[model samples]
Target chain A: MRRRASLVLLALAVFFAALSPLVRWYAFPRLAKIPPSQYQDMVLEAKNATLLDYTTMKSKKVPEVSIVQTLKGNVAAAGKVRERTGRDVVVWDTLSYVADDKGRMVSRIPERYVFDAHSQEPVHAGGEHVDGDPVRRRGIEYKWPFGTEKRDYEYFDFQTRTSAPIHYKGTRTVHGLETYYFEQTIPWTKVKVPKKLPLGATPETVEQLGLERWYTTKRMFWVEPVTGAPVDGQEIHEEEMRWTDKPGKKPLTAFAGHVRMRPDYQKATVDLVSSQRRLVLTLTTYLPWGSLALGGLLLVGSLTLEARTRTRGRPPGAGGPPVSSAAPGDPARARRPSPAPGGSGGMAPGAVGAFTGAFLKLLPGRRPPDQLTPAARVPSCARWVRPLRDPPAKGAWDSGRATRPAHPGSPPPRTTRDRR
Target chain B: MRALLAAAAGLAAALALVLAVTATGAPPGETSKKPLHTTVPAHP
Candidate 1:
């Protein structure tokens, strides 16, 4: 019965151990989900640009462009799972307003994003269908395993309303925690310039000021593996314009500056990542493996005890027929005696009985010596009677037996049976 | 031995449930109060 219980325990341990990977895949991603009614305010600045006067054809002092943007968003669960996709949809709305250095309103943009609840990838954004596997959503990537290499991801750009390929650049330590590094670079493209330039120039003069090309924009993110949160981010936006006919001329510096996430945000992200990582490590790695090891040991111990019990229960003289005690030339036969109940020329029956009684007492569910019946004690006594029945040869004592006497006062050998 | 193994299995199951429920119900990390910044060099 005890052995059966041990086997059941071992099976349960194996089951739990197998659950580790499932927790990592399903539970870990959910940690990165953005909740409803979340609000964030970010301040951005466009640094020193040449204040150009198109009417006077002269350059004034440089001016700074400052922007304060507020983002308020919410996520809601879909009522039913969509067709062709067994997962429910998650709807997200982010309303943002931007203001300049003088507190004048710049732009108010309302964006909508829809994603599959399971994959956390954008299905729709900005009233347009975005079809592709998403590498990231809301500044967080979904599922990144350790040792991941130069994998390419299709990233959706909210500003451009398009998807672009981003590359993983391996891992880096951020705030003392290892993180996956990913980068996206948008090349220079000829884009129609916005009506308002940072330096207070009109659209026609802006064209003449050489600010027509969208020079380059680079984005980098340091993402925590367990939670997939971006602990730190860097964005570099650059632009230059040229005359409609002049292609090779020195291009004027339209805008040049770098935007970085605030220290407070990074710190918060780091704390979240650390907590999530620790939880994952304990649940998925330590606990499962620990249970398996301990359960395995217990199973082995139970089996070993059962085998010993069977060996000890064997009848005396079962190994071979009884030999004559008077055989003079056969010292082996003379020294050994049949281990049968009431046998003679062997160890004392009382001593053998006491030793077997003590051994069985150590096992779980077995009666102590004082409670066992004489009939029950006979089999145990027969097990050890042979050694005591035969007296040792004269020279046997001289060899080592007398000198290496067993410790009389020592306690019985410890056994796992007591653990039950 | 049986009790210990049972306890371990119970612990793992409980932890998995807690994590799954928390992930589904609880909010993520709060946004920072500070705002992002980009400074144009004065001499640029």
Candidate 2:
């Protein structure tokens, strides 16, 4: 029985040990994918920002500018792309709407980003574009990949409509979660004018006016490494309307401010990312380490249990014919050190019994070791290990003498009452 | 038998933990109920 129990324990240990890496490497990679149904919205604010007054063709300072960013999962689009590309793809219909404090819309850009759910790498399938213009997407956008490394990653810039390397700045903690800080500096570059501009302005009209739009930004993000979620984000965004017809002309500030996630939105994002961090940690760190530790402990426990059972079967003088091998009246039988009247309560005897006894307590209606029959104490070892004397019909407890026969050198055997 | 039950309980607990971990990774739905780009009024 004990040998079987040890085998069971060993098996359990092996299962737990194997489950760790299986979940981390095999299952996590395949199954830990971004759901095609996930959608999220965030609000960011640029305080004391400057915006160009298109009617006056001049920069105007504003108390605040709000940018509401929404990302809606395009499940139908994702399904089509997945079929074509043979990859698990996700589509996010994203919109960044900028509005003044008075709720007057300044600008809004709509985009459809498609990428691999796990790697966050662009798949470049059909229906990829920014602001109704078909364009190939490259590099990470909106989010980093899971297990983000401390290295540079190519990040997409919507203004420049290109990919640039975002350098890993350093590590920092945001809302008590460790994160990797990354920054991207988009230098002054002539960018395409907005398709639709205020005051009846369009790209053609801006070109007719000999004015070109230039943009630069220093974007910073604090991203939680485990889930690749941003806890806090900021951007020093600056845009200008420059003169292409004239030389050394000062450009009109189109929009400029240090944009930051709204305080409440930042808190909300941190809280969400914190919870997700725990989930990722469970899969990558806690579960794997815990399984390994449990496996090691159970392995040791089973080995101890098996070894004790074996040692318990052999007598002090193992050289002698095994305990029950000698006949009842044989000199070898008479010399064996017989145990006292106390029984093991259907368990192994000695210190090992004390160890296993705690687990035995889980059984219902089990008698205490001291009250059980000597026959109950006799473990289910091989027959040769049983007492030299023949067992009584109903076990030793049913017989008047509860104790086994004493060795010739020992004192007489004691009954249960005498021991009491 | 009792030890086996205890071992079985441990295994069940471990399995439950793993299940919970995997379930947490399963994205449920839209995190925010706000309407999509439709909510934005035409750019003024």
| Model 2 segments more than 4 A misplaced | A319-420, B1-34, B37-44
Q: What would the per-residue lDDT of candidate 1 be over residues A295-356, giving only the tens digit for each residue?
A: 45654454344334333444332322112333223446434534434221122234333443
* Superposed Cα deviation of residue A391, candidate 1 (Å): 36
Candidate 2, TM-score of its B chain: 0.54
Tens digits of per-residue lDDT for model 2 on A201-274? Answer: 78899898898889999999998988998888999999988889886989899999999988887887888888
| Candidate 2 pairs with clashing backbones | A324-A384
lDDT for each of the candidates?
A: 0.48, 0.72
Judge candidate 1 against the unseen true structure and give its global Cα lDDT, from 0 to 1.
0.48
Looking at candidate 2 chain A, the ten consecutive residues that score lowest on lDDT are: A317-326
Superposed by TM-score, candidate 2 places the C-alpha of residue A6 at a distance from the truth, in angstroms, of 0.6
lDDT of 2 at A399: 56
RMSD of each: 14.2, 9.5
Compute the interface RMSD for candidate 1.
10.3
The model with the greatest lDDT is 2
User: What DockQ does each prediction reach against the true complex?
Assistant: 0.10, 0.19
